[model samples]
Target chain A: MIENELRPKVNEFEIQGTNFSDYQSPLFIAWQLNSICNLECLHCCEEAGEIMPNELNREEVMDFCQQIVDLNIPYVAISGGEPMMHPDFFKICEFFRSNGISLKVETNGLFINKEVAARFGKLGFRSVQISVDGASQDTFEKMRIKGNFKKVIEACKFLVEAGVNTEIVFVPTKFNIHETGKLIDMSYDMGIYGFYTGKIMQIGRAGQNWDILCPSAQEYEEFFKVLTEKEKQYAGKMKVYYYPYDVIEELKYRLEKPSASLLVIPNGKTKLIGPLPFVCGDLRKSKLSEIWNDYQKAWKKDEVISFTKQVIENPELLKEANKWREL
Target chain B: MEFQKHVKVRQEKFGAVVFETLREKIFVTNESGAQILSLLQAGKEPEAVTNELSSMYDGDPAVIKKDVDEVISTLQESGIIKN
Candidate 1:
């Protein structure tokens, strides 16, 4: 979460003739469609399990989509405790697609059967990233508790068969670092278009289990070496993307030029990413443009900068930041 | 003719990218194609587009008209513009 965790792939964006820097309104929106989920993942970023009482209703969601259309923002990446589980998931997808906004989905892939896959393909999603954290079923189930690895694999196969641009997302940690190569091979065999992996962030459920789940520096170094080899091996076959977090770089970027992206949680509030638990404004009460303006200014505030520094110095503060905060 | 309400045309450094929302498709065009799209987006007719191009470039009027007609046809076929 310390980085622009939901930044769309540069190559993919370029292919669509989208240059994020050129946009007036924030072009990329990382939307948490809901707070309810089917699985209790070990590193659940939102600590998402139960439904939030104030999650956006159908009308509100439609209004939000209208605001997006008004702003002419081109892309949105939908995630959640599980976005597919949201009752209006398909409707939301259809709204965005019909409005000419490109969309990408981040899901656990459990809900995607053949019929759902056909619907997804029909929706023409730019890409669908499915999380299959480990190379083996035991390792995967260890991270995504109660998740069936075979079902996820089957889901990927179905999505590919449906002609959807499918990719795999892996978050590496101490427990699953050894399976990196195997996971890549598995993804390639499934006809995945891309393989996106990142280092586990020190926030959310992951922050709670940092000691047990976070990989050692040496482990990351080893993993990157393997990743480098895999990139070369998979060149021209499957795109490989890895985002290693750098807190200092992220802090600078936030201070100077924050991403032209906003994180809209399930409760219709826009929250700052990482250990800064600051809410810019409530989307329910404000327009997207107003919230976006407040967001840009929030990064420049001394309170935000100092608090971010404090969090970096004392990682324990992240636990407090992970929860919803009024301001 | 006008670009569809759901269709958005964005000018990029290389050319222009046209988004057809109903179909969930993106189309890229070269410099001249981008000019043509911009004109169409501004509600220019095919004849007006040809006239504008005739004034902008040193090409023959007939050839420019032919090119405009071809570009307009492509845009219509792609559902980016409509009468």
Candidate 2:
């Protein structure tokens, strides 16, 4: 809605209504496969590099797949330092698909070659979003060290041709801000379905470099303005989402009730929100119904509300929010 | 004693819609199937369900019991229900 707040005269093109509806039993899930990442990007949040010692083993993950199905979370977003980096990535995908959950995988596109791209299309995944920090190799390499921009673009093309619904995530950082327009253009030209752009948060490795990488006030304002104009121009041809996402605002009273969205960390802990460290209950220790009650209760805590408020007000707080101490 | 993890039920105007949860690619049934599931979900035991259905429909006890037995066993085999 913040995107609509800019110009007062409701343009006919003014995107009206909302995609969110009443939350059902089990709606969405943010399921982390592992923190292990193949790339060490400068902006790596979660600072995920190598697999952690207590990371869930294969058997544990397989065991929990049934639990996740038991939870009935219909929409799952499989994420990680790099989710494709998980050895059992496809196995996990197969489990969720067999049980009835549609998945959206967030990956760095490094692992998706042409053959893999074709197989990925057949997996029943709803979408596969690859993070494209910059339009060109130089800017992309500097922001996400060791990235192959050409390879990612080629992967996207292959995936699109293979019938996999591909999308691009453009995180606006100092290095990539200038090229986002071209990136959007490329996504539209390439027939990519959606283009999502959001401000960088102060979390993970990005938190360490926030002072230098985070856009200045003028730069931030200018970026969204550019996005707004492009969104208007690309209106129907390519879907665009500019963030400072008021996604949850429309569900005000609903947030107070219970979140149908479940977050399961690699350690099998049920995290309240993406940032909130409050552990509801370990999924391994309790039934989802019992832990789910804890999830509902966690939402009412003062810390949770205040955290939500801060990020809603200053989306930049996202970078440091998960740190909790800063909150 | 519980519905399988993938088992899910959706209520409609006529009756309920039941299906295997993920991908919903497995079992899906309506009417009497949905009614039996709703009863089980509400914590009714197998024998109790047969008795209840017999009383509600005024069907022969032996006939209803036989049908319920077949349905319950099929549910068990499909892993949609457990003891």
Prediction 2 TM-score vs. true:
0.70
Interface RMSD of each: 12.9, 19.6
Q: How much lDDT does each candidate structure score? A: 0.79, 0.70
Task: Give the alpha carbon lDDT tens digit for every residue of A99-202 in model 1.
Answer: 87878899999999999999999988878999989999999999998899999999999999999989899999887999999999989999999999887766
Candidate 2 wrong stretches, greater than 4 Å:
A1-24, A245-259, A302-327, B1-83
Q: What's the TM-score of every candidate structure?
A: 0.79, 0.70
Model 2: per-residue lDDT, tens digit, A1-327? Answer: 002221111111111121112222345668877888878888776777888657778888887777667655656788987999888999999888777676789999999999999988878567789988888899998988878999999989988988887889988888889887888999988888789877675667887787778887788788888899889989978878876643234224335544456777777777766544456767667776676666766677787777667666765666653443311
DockQ of candidate model 2? 0.03
lDDT of 1 at B81: 72
- Place model 1 in a CAPRI quality band: incorrect
Find the 10 residues in a row with the least total lDDT in model 1 chain B.
B17-26
Q: What TM-score would chain B of candidate 2 score versus the native chain B? A: 0.77
- The residue-by-residue lDDT of candidate 1 on B1-83, one tens digit each, is 86765465667665566665333466666667778778877878788888887787766788777667777777777666774
